[model samples]
Target: MVFAHAPVAIAPLALISLGGLFWLWQKAETPFQSMQIGLGFGLGYFGTGVSWLISSIYLYAEMNLVLSVLAVLCFILFLTLYFILAGWLVARLKTAQRQGFNWVVVMPAVWVFAEWVRATLFGGFPFLMTGNTHLMTWLDGYAPVFGVLGVSWAVAITAGILLWLVQSRAWVGASLVLAVLWLTGASLKNVEWVTPKEKPVEVALLQGNVPQDDKWLSKEFLPTLKRYVGLTKQNLDADIVVWPETAVPAYYDVVERGALRSFIRDAQLLNTDILLGVITRDDSHRDYYNAIVNAHNPEQQYQKKHLVPFSEFFPFSSVLQPLSELFNIPFSEFTPGADDQAPMTLGGHPVGLSVCYEMAFGEELIDSARQADFLITVSNDAWFAHTLEPAQQVQDVQMRALELGREIARSTNTGYTIIVGTNGQLKAEIPPYETGVLRGEVQPYEGETPFVQWRQWPILILLLGVMLLLVWLKLQARPSRKTTAED
Candidate 1:
């Protein structure tokens, strides 16, 4: 899992790791032992895979080393519980009469279902989902139709089949099954689900390279504003010029009272749209929003709906105020935007916009993305500077692009400023942690991938339907026993 997730990003490692873990689960004498093995696997998997979490907590959250390490351990343990659950389930099933069927079919089902649960429950953490590891693999074609979870299903099933082959040596049957699964995806890769617009839109994605700790400092605010303004002016030739999340480092009113109008007018004069991120206030409602707005048309905006946990909003704030102060987190109370809000129109094209962590939640982006010609995610990843988190985030962005079959423009404050093509390939990129503009052409796509139309329902229904059918079959196979009360 660690090798497959990021920085390393080796796809086959995930398969080998999952298969080996499954083998251990089957080898365990009892489900309880299987769960213990799974707990260890989880510790290794997430402890290394998401090691970047320690960087974020230690740096931005301002937590002490002991507390940060403990906090991260708790998070890893939480993620590991799901793996333990899978292990217990697989162990019990592997002992069933239909051992071959259980290992090949039921195990994958268990793994993917757990993934879906992890992705949905507790506001979702959809990271290192395994499916994204296959982004460049033949199985990537499954994304547009089945979504990331579905692709994960394919990987798990394949891994299970490989495990079966190792034990049974039923080479022909396994080969045939693998051939069908893989070749089908290979064919699907060529099917263009979305058509491009007549004219491609030019985009200039700005990387501000602002230090996270210095972002909100009063002295740095004007310089940050000036940096973005200068960058936008230089890139006004683009159809849309974009700034990273919170590039202004100030509220809407603060910028408006200073340079907002002139900035908008400058873009308007050039017939360009500046899509930039900033904090917006609703004074009457006392609401704060992490938002992206069109400088040329402020009303054209998208407020981020999916907020990062703890930093965005404390899960149980009333009882956690002391914890919040200990961490020194900011923007902990920003209001989430309405789901049905209109997509932001940027550079004469409708855009599905995501901010920072929200890119990991595909459903959060899908509603607007279905109606959008393209997608743009503005993020401030400086909190995770010099870590795999940003590149890992890019992997998630690629998954979204492949799922939706639409080009994605990713703008970030610290690093990983890049454009992902509809095929989930990097079309263009600006070097990480650098101050620069990545100029690229995004072809607006006109149709929806199956995923964009149904979100995660197909995968869920398919998984649920299969398990239900299997349950019915198992019930039918059981012998009937009649019991009578003795007189």
Candidate 2:
């Protein structure tokens, strides 16, 4: 699972790891043993894969070291329950034939279903998904057609095939099948599902290397705002300029009549449009939102629809309020934006805007991107500073661009200010722990990929059909087993 992530993402190894998992499941003699095996593997996989959670909780939540570790463990243990259920289902569904139908069909189907459920339930995590490992591989071509979950289904099916090959020792047939699958993926990479709609627009993405410990300090707030404004001033020639999430540490109302207005006036003088992240509030309603606003027109804003759990809003605040107070968490409550909010317009082009963790939900972004010419996602990843979380986040953004067939401008606090092309390739990026402006031109794309138009329905339907077929086969075999017992 560690290797399945960035910096060492060996794509093929994901197949091997999952195949080994299925092979181990085949050895379990009882349902209890099967669930145990699944839970153990899941614990190890997620425990290492998402270990960065510990750093985020400790740094942002201000928890003690031991409590942070426990928090991470508890989260992983909850996620592992999905795998345990998958194991129990597989054990119930597997027929007497250990190596043929169950290994190649039922097991893979159950695994993919389990992954989909994990990504759907409880507002979803969707991190460290198996298909993310194939970002650089030819299999990534499948993204536009079937989305990430479809790619995950393909990977799991291939792993099941590998398990069958190992058991049957049919190296030649297995080799042919593997070669055919990869070659097909390679061919699919050449297809273009979306085209450029407008001339390239020059963009400047600002990365403010703000220290997380000092970011929320009262004394440092003005300095941090000045730093971003100064950095943005250096690239006013760009068509659009972006700031990281919550670039203004204070709320919009608090800064609107002061430094923020002056910043907007300066940008307007240069004939540049600026979009910056800030906290927005509805005074009459007493509601707060994590949002982005156009510097020139503060009225034009995009509120983040998908709020991060715990960090943005505590799920069971009534019950966990004491725990939050104990940990000294700031900004522990926020109301989500309306679900059907439209894309914000900037510089005469519709821009799909996502704040921080909102970009993780590809399906939700599809509506935002339907008429958008380009995409912008801003984040303050300083919470997970010095961890792989930010890098993995960049990769996830790249995949979203590929799936939607749109170019992405990702602005972030503390690094990885990037411009990604429609093909999901990095066009330009700033190094981590640096304060700089990544200047680049991104061509606005129109039209949608298949995944964008249909979303997850196609893949979900296919999986459902497979599960129904398995059930039918299981029922058909039941009568035969009874007849043999009577004979």
By TM-score, the best candidate is 2
**Per-residue CA lDDT of candidate 2, range 270-305, in tens?**
667788888888987468899998886666889988
In model 1, which runs have C-alpha deviations exceeding 4 angstroms?
A: 96-99, 259-261, 472-487
- Give the RMSD in angstroms, all C-alphas superposed, for model 2: 1.8
- Angstrom error at residue 274, model 2: 0.8
Q: What are the clash counts of all predictions, listed in order?
A: 0, 0
Query: lDDT tens string, model 1, 1-487?
Result: 7788777888888889888877776678888998898899889988887888887788777789898998899999999999899887766555456545776787888889888888888888898897988888889899999899888988988898888888886889988998999999999899989999868999999999998888878888778888888888888789888999988877887777676667766655678888879888787847889999888777788888888776777788788867877676656678888878877777788888889888898777788788899988899889889887888899999999998878999999988999999999999998888899999998898988999888888889999997786667666765666422331
Q: What is the lDDT of residue 391 in candidate 2?
A: 80
